[model samples]
Target: MSRSTLWLLFAVLAVAARPAAAAFPADANPDPRSISVSGSAEIKVPPDEVLLSVGVESRAIVLADAKRTNDADVAKALAFLRASGVADKDVQTDYVNIEPRYPYDSGAKVVARLQPEFYVVRKSIGVRLTRVGAYEEVLAGLLANGAQYVHGIEFRTSQLRKHRDAARALAIRAAQEKADALASELGVRRGPVRSVSESYSGGWWRGGSGGWGNVGGGQAMQNVIQQTGDGGNGEDGTLAVGQISVNATVSASFAIE
Candidate 1:
């Protein structure tokens, strides 16, 4: 070959044979300098509000009579609630039910027949009490206003968002600290946070208040026994308020440094 052509060919060969750039250190190990860890945090907050369940029940041989009586009784209860500072929005109708009371068949060897039965109607309302102590006065008012059927009282918190946010922040901080500690133990420095999560709604209701129910004109003692059996330890002659409960739980993950 000519000298110039040979020189050009040699330069081209050298350019293409540059050792493949060292193949980027194939099978390169990680820094081996960091560790990962998870952490959790929890916070408990006192309940800030209470829930009251109250209502009235009425019965009569005629369905219309029963409904009218119930309507009057409920109106009275609502009036009492309104006067007791329960806002229109806060007072909610929880339930209304109407059922028939049947008569026993007293005929022997007779054709099957059904008799028109009396009607029993019940209506209930849920009252949200911001101040727990207000339960006493509220109960008195409800009783004075002809509240016949008081169902139950539940307690809860109104400032749920505040507690939840605080818990979450704490959880994140705890997780970051854990990650840092793990990294320190492994002789490495923390990098950047990769993820975080938390659960804030871990609360429960322990005990509650009590109220009354009217057993309209039947077996009073039997009715009272049945009611007590049904309500458990909540059998108070007048009204009782329940305690509120709030709980928060959080879990967080941070990148290992």
Candidate 2:
């Protein structure tokens, strides 16, 4: 090869071997020093509303007979509820099911392909009571009027949004207080907030065999503070309308100075 051609090839090879430049310099923008903390708060208040799940189940050798019995019982229960001042909008049919019950063999296993012993028809209804005080009376009337199964009862607050907002505000303040306390111990001061995140949960608890239960959507988290209110009871003291808990958690990062 000629000297000029060899020089041109060398130049191409040198260019190909060179490292690429970075898009951003390493020291152009460094991450700020920050302190991360999490805080939570819980607010308890008397429930203003109650939700009840009631159902009726009937069985017979004929499907039509079982369905008829279930329908009549449900109608009676609904009529009783209406008479007790429950509004139409607050009452809804939750579900309806029809299944066959087969006879069990001597070995306790269900017999296959044999004639069904009986047909079962079940219907469930949801009732929302705006007046928390009338829970006992309404429940008794439901049972007397043919509501056979009590699936569950949930006590809740109508002002859930207001209480949740208040809880979130308290949680943020708690986070700020924690950051300040930590900074004071380290002989540093907390600066402007750099990042923030939050989560929340709400639920109810009963006094009997059943324990804590979730009423709606939300994940459980640690609570920093808890307060309990009066267990709302009726004049006869048959039912206890316990307070509901609204909880919130906040995670925040603040600059350290």
Backbone Cα, N, C clashes tallied per candidate: 7, 0
Best by TM-score: 2
lDDT at 105 for candidate 2? 75
Worst 10 residues of 1 by lDDT: 218-227
Residue range 26-107, candidate 1, lDDT tens digits: 6674444434455555554444566667667788999999999999988888888888888898888778889888766776
TM-score of 1: 0.61
Which candidate tops lDDT?
Answer: 2
Give the per-residue lDDT of model 2 (tens digit) for 139-158: 77887897766666677788
lDDT of each: 0.61, 0.78
> lDDT at 231 for candidate 2?
56
